[model samples]
Target chain A: MEPIKNDILDYLKDNSFMDTNIGLEDNDSLTQNGIMDSIGLLELMDYICEKYAIEVPEDMLTPENFDSLQGITNLIVKLVK
Target chain B: MSRIVCKKCVLDSDMPGIDINEESGLCHFCETYVPFSAQEKSDYLEKMEELFREYGGRGNYDVVFALSGGKDSSYTLHKLKNEYPFLKVLAVQFDNGFISDNAVENAKKMCELTGSDYFKLTMENEVLYETFRKAAESRDAFPRLAKYRASDICNTCISIIKQKLIEEAIVQDAPFIMFAFTPGQSPNPIIPLKANFIRWSRSIFEKQLQKIGVEDKDEKFLIKNEVIESMGKEGPRMLHPLCLWDYNEGQILESLVEIGWNPPDLNDSNSTNCTLNSFACQNHLEKYGIHPYAFDIAGIVRSGDMSREEGLEKLHQALSQPLIEEAAKKLNCR
Candidate 1:
């Protein structure tokens, strides 16, 4: 796994109710699969801010960027870049 | 009557007034799985933080928080105090006459630990019981079906507390009012509090009050004149920080524990506070054929904080509480 994927996994593990089988290639329907809810999404935004030192714009918390591990990883990459 | 099942899920037409597509059998609520775009959520959070900071961070003491001492409210109080230390949190508790000792303790502990000023309001049990009995007798006691399943008496208590909070805020020159409502409960974007909105809400209740033989003049006390007078002076904006942060039960528990907060074990079976909750759920289920907590618990389960089996168990326990039996008699459900 890449370093960023590891970070995502670690963050999920620290939070609650994330799948134990989460991986880079795992299914990304977090909301559909019950891995997270609306509030959970907000918490993830906070985590990203504290972890990557990225100021997540409020507009970035939609389903497009947070649907899966890959999506979140993409978001982090963009912010870090 | 023909049954209407969601083509996407098992939700049936008999569920409520929900309509399903004839071709797909999917209802609008079910069809819209993904609610927000990632960008919208991020922008909303950032905007919320900026608003809080611009309103004075901890410097401006312009609002009162309605702290129920539940998980959501506790979490909200924690964030409000942490982010805006100077904000005066007026923790108000409406003793419905049967609040659990643990709930009372939690309310007291939250105030003591935070050093926020606190107040308790209790209504006469007989009067509350009489009002609730009358409201339950009337089918339309509470016209807003989306927000609450509480008895008419419970509704009366909530109205009284809400009015009191607004009055106290205005008298104290506070500019905002806050509650712990989640997105599914109250989804309006965070904005400046308006007194006209308060008046409109009061009018809604005034109609209901008249139906139950409550005089219009009596409703005036339910909403104070001073609060109405100060509406244009920039009343407090109602904030829900819990909506701003991503929250899961585990994360909330851990964070609260770290801050010296504790959850009541009884909440595991029924509720954290409000002895009447189990009864309330029972009343809703008996009348509506579904638990009022169904939507909230389903949301949580769908979000992965709890298992479906666990949700069912909680539902069953809530239905089986002795309070339900007592409430049944009181509401003439039997």
Candidate 2:
């Protein structure tokens, strides 16, 4: 989870112009807190698919699955398993 | 830096990725933009049909159409109803106190003509106007960025529309929310990402909102959180239908006129709905010295609907004091 979270945090900062100074927490609600938006979700989905070599089942593109680093990590771990 | 306007279009140096080739007088965005091939367009239409088939009738309202009573949205509703009749659609229009009378009536008439359920969600104008005033008055960086994105008045109105559409999607169990934003309405596809930008904008707006007497609960509506926690990941997906299909304003207006939809009498030549559009547009122009609709107009030019000269004429509008005054009266921003 830490490695995945770290990679995602870096990706957000590098790719999306997310402010690294704010310091995203593992439990921070990215979308709910307005740190990300619809386009952000699309970018993240694309990144996760390429990074993990797993297509996020369309049904799993829900809020709970990608709400935070923690939730996204869980979804990725489950999909990889 | 001295601002360089695009030779072919209205885009200026302020626009991201805008590189004016000294020889050609065009920017890279315009030079590199290629309209979809016929085969690609056909494939996209087929995919849209597939989406409609899969999502149609899955809920009480299978889709929620964000209706602005503009030609694009009206045409989208028309085509969807005529072409994909099986889908249950709910048209939602947000009243931002500046929506033209004809637009409001047109929205109602379109719903009646198409036999679709319509919801007119009206916002508290006091708060709306105060926010608009702040948008007009505030020169702070984040607030200014908010203005630069959607104009001062439009940002507040659009925030309400966004909140309402998502809620309607959830409440009606609509699996998809359809927007009629054409490729023309999109940005450069590489505009600066608004990371923590909404939160910052919301905070600035909220300060004005509280001063204008809105409750805390209402403030939450302005926050865009659905991408995270609002619907628990099962929220309806926003679908831009026009991006999949070929459309030009002229064709859409002609089709709509045939079906009894008249363009609104408005100040903005490009706008056929909101009365305050020109006001916000002029404000942005005054502040940024760049047309807010540069991308939209450039998109239209790239898509071959209108000549770049025509687009420039529309963007570099001569001053219309009477119209601005009237729109200001409507918004009470003056």
Candidate 3:
């Protein structure tokens, strides 16, 4: 698994809402599926900061980068790069 | 009042008398939640409990409640104490520099009556008044206005109070910190926030705070490190017990009165136990074009606790006074 994908999955598990099997390509629309909300997005941002040591800029917290597991992984890759 | 549907939720504008822009079919409240959920109550509680356990509760004191001496907080404090006698309460009050004497009395009386420990933190009137003036004069004042609707001073006052309560919770090693928030004001259910989360959330408002030129460092006076460090691994959980149960305003008021919580005379135009409330409501309407009380009152009405006409009449009465010169003077607005 990609490092970003692993970190995102770890975060989801830490929050107690996701399992290890959930992956980037496996229907990752958490918001549309009701697995997350704005607050969840925020918690995700915090998790990314702690786990990946990435500081997500305020503008970067958009739906395109955070609405799904794929989006979150993409965001992590972008921020880490 | 035209019906306003939250472009996101099942909430309607008329459902809470929220002022809506007809063309957009949205209200200010809905706009703030565009990135959020319908705020399920059950999920919130479960999240809060999970946080409570994760934070570790050993050697932790009971919850620290921000008691406004109002019906909601007072009732919440009473309920928590009654249900969980093991729960110790640290009641903290923010002296807005102009609290009604009756409110002071109520705060004292209720603490004594409930046998709960209490503390009152008074902010510098000069500094508080100046912040209020600046916030009131700012264009983005509407968000602050919507929250309190009491006065410009109130936005400043609550910021201080919130900081103090968090600090106190940490200092006292309290595992949980609770407020008396109802649904419309802040839609979230119970929250377990770490010191870092609190810091991050406050950072979101840094721009707003900078607009008023209140130094970020000054936040330390309200939020102390000792408290933060003392706050165990589990950050404090902010709970609003009122949301957990179906409660009517009348039932709450009656229960409070039964417990010796007296309502200040409604005839006192300039005062109530919550002196800042009327002014908060007035300023809210002035800036936001909606009554600050509208959200709470509308919630009560929607819950069938009050009649729409009664809510409107109460709102009208609350807003009846022209902005008081004394209030502006206290706020140092010329």
Q: State the DockQ of every prediction.
A: 0.02, 0.09, 0.05
Residue A70 in candidate 1, Cα distance off native in Å: 48
lDDT of 1 by residue, B1-334 (tens): 6986454433356654355778766755455554445576678667766765666434234557777777777777777677667666677776666566766777778888777877776767766665655655555454323323234445555666677777666666565677776543434345444555455445555655666666647443366665577556355665655555665766776887787776765533545666666666555555555445544554444434456566556645634456666655655555
Query: What is the lDDT, from 0 to 100, of the residue B283 in candidate 1?
Result: 53
* B321 Cα displacement, candidate 2 (Å): 2.4
> What is the lDDT, from 0 to 100, of the residue B225 in candidate 1?
62
Model 2 C-alpha lDDT per residue in residues B1-334, reported as the tens digit of each score: 7778777666777664355777777776666666767787777678767767876776789878889898889998988888888888899987777788899899998999888999988767776666666666644322222333456456556656765676677667777777777677642222111223333334444554444344446444565445423444344666776765666667788989999997777756867887777787788777656455776777777787778788888877764677778877855766
Q: Write the per-residue lDDT of candidate 2 for residues A1-81, one digit (tens) a residue.
A: 789888888776644435457767788876545456444566677678878999776566565777688889999999999
Give the CAPRI class of candidate 1: incorrect
Best model per DockQ: 2
The regions of model 3 sitting more than 4 angstroms off are: A1-81, B1-60, B141-153, B220-222, B225-233, B266-272, B318-323
Angstrom error at residue B2, model 2: 7.9
Instruction: Compute the lDDT of residue B139 as modeled in candidate 2.
Output: 41
Question: Residue by residue across B7-39, what tens digits does model 3's lDDT show?
Answer: 433334543234465677555444534222226
**Candidate 2 chain A lowest-lDDT run of ten:** A31-40
lDDT of 2 at B192: 19
